[model samples]
Target: MPDTAASSTHLTLLDDLLKRALAHGADAADAVMIRSDSVGASWRMGKAEDLERSESTDVGLRVIRGKKQAVVATTDLNPAGFDELAERAIAMAKVSPDDDYCGLADPALYATDLQDLDLDDHPDQGAERLIARAREAEEAALAVKGVKQSEGGSASVGRTTMALAIRGEGARFEASYSASSHSVSCSVIAEDGNGAMERDYDFSSARHFEDLDSPADVGRRAAENTVRRVGARKMGSGKMPIVYDPRVSGGLVGHLSQAVNGASVARGTSFLKEKMGQKIFADGIRIVDDPLRQRGLRSRAVDGEGVAVRRLNLIDDGVLQSWILDTSTARQLGLETTGHAGRGTGGPPSPGPTNLYMEAGRLSVDDLIADIQEGFYVVELIGMGVNYVTGDYSRGAAGFWIENGRIAHPVSEMTVAGNLKDMFRQITPASDLTFRYGVNAPTLRIDGMTVAGA
Candidate 1:
């Protein structure tokens, strides 16, 4: 850890331990330090129901001797504690069994220049403010006409600091961010004596509270979504085009991408083995992983291994471009790291996407559905039924009916089944691109999917 005067001084302590490890018969070493603070408040039935606040700091060190490596981590930040931890890590490394694949990243691959990212920095607003926000969101939900009882509402805030250092190639960075989120949900009893409806809305803001969604707006949307679900019925089972809203589309794409990772390929478990440069999807489909998006939820200047991060094309114009790779997996497969390493003190690094997103399409959501005689606009899915090695896919789905380009009624308790390989090639995307989460996608349409229902 480079020297810093802030709370992240534990980073320096970690750096010092790494140096000690190198001097104590280790070939390579690295260190990481992290500090975080969080607060939360909840309101229900017009009263405060729960509140919590906490802060914590931790440091970890790793040592590698030839083919053997060991790691030790501790939340205690005192100098004496750090020294003991370092000694223990070296001792563990000495006794560890040697494997051919364990080592620190090459010095040539380390990032030198650090990027100045703008993360959250706001004065701590006490529990009272959090409670107030929770109450406001809940009250707005309860005020809706058909809302009989609010299930609950909550507000939360979190701040974090992180630092990293490597032995021979010293690199250091410090970043802090603040995030707040509020959510409200309610159950509505219909006036016609038909049944009950339920829904919820959530709003999140980073940097400050002013960026959050209005309580009234959240409440109204929740009420609308809930009301639409009333009297949902099952549809006849058949193969048809399926449209996935942005929220659900992201999850669908994520599942597909995970199966294409290089680690899985190296292990002979990826369905995409030997499919590089092959046409794997519709002509318009593209999947990209970007780590430098400004203020992006998962954006980072460097990967977990201190490698420079950049945008990578996983799939371009339906062609399988590349698979996500970490250092170990890349080495095993004779490829370069894709700057997708995800690891911490306790485990080896794994490949993961940074701000993964699918490129938007030309047609608006309505236009994409206009020609469909019948379809389903999926809003949510439950339970997982995906086989990475075989590319088989199935899941429980619930959403609204699409008829002649219009949303008709909600449908529930159905199953969607198809081969992921076929589904990718048959899919189409809508023009609506909303950036609300780490994984994002436009509304997507997959044709000829099997929907199991009555």
Candidate 2:
């Protein structure tokens, strides 16, 4: 049982520790404390199989003296342990390299008006309850006719609190988030006894349990998806239009986003380097990275480096607008930080996007497909083969064959290859956009992709 009251007290203690670190030896200090609890349950063969519940807290201290800086973290939060951690961090900072850019963020850049977003409010669902839900989902999937084996079904709940404090600057912020997820997967042996096809469906709800999809719904969808792939075959190789379902399109967008990070740009590993203000995509394509999306999984008032977050237009009407940036990478490139820093206690902060999404187009998925005579509607991809520097893109894909504006048959064991530069310029998005994850996009169609199949 986790006590919210105790968590709040611990957060205050962490703030006090930051002040103490600055007083002890560090010219500046920042502290972060995170407490998280999670419950997970899995079911197989229509019965509860695995159940897990865990709670943990981690505290990190970053000390800076001029250009020298060091970070130390520990799961121990006891009074003596906390004091020792601060001392160790200060001592480590003494021997660190003097990089002129390494220091706490300027006080002027700190966020002041923090929003009261309730990210951790959820009904209490015990381990038994989660196991029951998992069993129900598994049973529902097994009930579908022709379903041969259930891979597994699961339900999970998680709660997390994050607190940060910067000394002297007197900036502090705390936020919490709660989430629940349910997933089911099933495999069906084809009637021809030649192959087995597996598919999965998952639904995740944040902030409230009522937002979650029903276990039966997840199970039924998993079964339906598996059945549809029972007779999958290979198609002949050729250049054709490729339609990507929303789930697959999101991943494709993620790869592109990674290539636009300031770190990649500074390291000369991104193909988008020096392409700012240039046309990078089709005329209708637009992409935005918004950190203020209400109840968004990645939404935060301040970035990891304590900079206020804001919406950024990475691409507007096909033109490259800006690259995602963190403090260090931004300074390296002589650009301002874009409030995209993502930090963990284990490593230095890195640039990242929050709630990155592609702007939806006006055409529906069906309407987008109607104009294509032959294509592949990609549902999933396997293996990463994208080259950020050269912009060469190739991936193993599985999907359904689209013929005459309708999905005709399932296809598998194919490779789709194209250059990122050309792919971005030729891609088109459908209007059926759904916000299911931190990064989202609508179904997208790419013209003239080389499909390598039998």
TM-score of each: 0.92, 0.93
lDDT of 1 by residue, 1-454 (tens): 1223553555557667776777777677777776777888888888999999878876767777778888888887777665677778889988989867767666567777756544454446488987887777777767767666666667777766667677743433323223223322333332324654545354555444555566556556665566666677899899999999886899867976787787788899988888999999888789888877766667777777778788988889999998898888888888888888876666666789888888999999889999888899898788889899898999999898988879988888888999998998998888898777788999999999999978
Model 1 collision count:
1
Per-residue lDDT of candidate 2, residues 1-454 (tens digit): 1235764786678777886787778887777776777888888876677888888888778888778889998987777667778888888888988877666565677666655444445557588878877777777777877677877778888776666666754544443323333333333232336655556454555555665677777777677777777777898999999999987899877987988999899989999898999999989688989887766667777777778888999989999999898878888888888889887776567899999999899998989999788999998898989999999999999989999999999989999999999999998998988887788999999999999999
lDDT of 1: 0.74
Scored by CA lDDT, what does every candidate get? Answer: 0.74, 0.78
Worst 10 residues of 2 by lDDT: 181-190
After superposition, which runs of candidate 1 have C-alpha atoms over 4 Å from their true positions? 1-4, 168-192, 205-210
In candidate 1, how many Å is residue 206 off?
3.6
